[model samples]
Target: MNSPVVSKNAEGAYSVKAPLRGIRKSCKYIFSNIYLYVDKNPVYQPLQLWSDEQVLQHQAFEKEQGFELTEFKNFEDIKEMSCDFKEYGICEVTDGSLPDMTYHVSTKEHTLTFDVKEK
Candidate 1:
């Protein structure tokens, strides 16, 4: 059999690196598919996943500006929205949105916070 394409290493052996922003882990490609990684372990609920085409579009947009752009797994994460506004009546925190690398969610009238690894 062939050897593992990407065995574990000191920094975790893998050709593709996780996205440095809010994106899902479900959406994927051969490598450099941060969307796939985020789909598995998303910071926000409803787990926003992107298509390979979408990733390409986003990258292309950034390239047009001649600079690396921050990527988000889900569109909701990049937008200014708050699930808490309706769920927990919290005006500050929100759900489906990663704020400063943190995700706030409401469950049974209670809001919870989860730390995330976006990059």
Candidate 2:
């Protein structure tokens, strides 16, 4: 059997040192309030990870007819989406608190926060 070895420094103190950072395996996470749009402007706030699963479901919906999700930085890029919903929407069935409303998209490349401008 191999035995453990102890070493002392110049001060004659022996100790064991542990790693500072890596992998983040045992990290703790706390929830933050996720606000989609605020100030009634064309800008969208940053996305929090708490709702990441919901974002995935949205991508699946777009894939039903064989159209896979394409990541875009702006709301205008979505073929079916128009207007500054990221800021304000003046369309039917569009509301401030729609469960499916997203100014955020989570993708393999990155997560984007939107900033909208008045037209």
Q: What is the number of backbone collisions in each predicted candidate, taken in the order shown?
A: 13, 3
| Candidate lDDT values, in order | 0.36, 0.36
Compute each candidate's TM-score over C-alphas: 0.25, 0.26
**So what's the TM-score on candidate 2?**
0.26
Q: For candidate 2, write residues 25-88 as lDDT tens digits.
A: 5773322213332234443333222234455565777887688794423332332312455535
Q: Please identify model 2 stretches exceeding 4 Å from their true place.
A: 1-25, 28-34, 40-52, 55-100, 107-113
Model 2 score (lDDT): 0.36
Tell me which residue pairs clash in candidate 2: 42-87, 42-116, 43-116
- The numbered model that scores best in TM-score is 2
Clashes of 1: 13
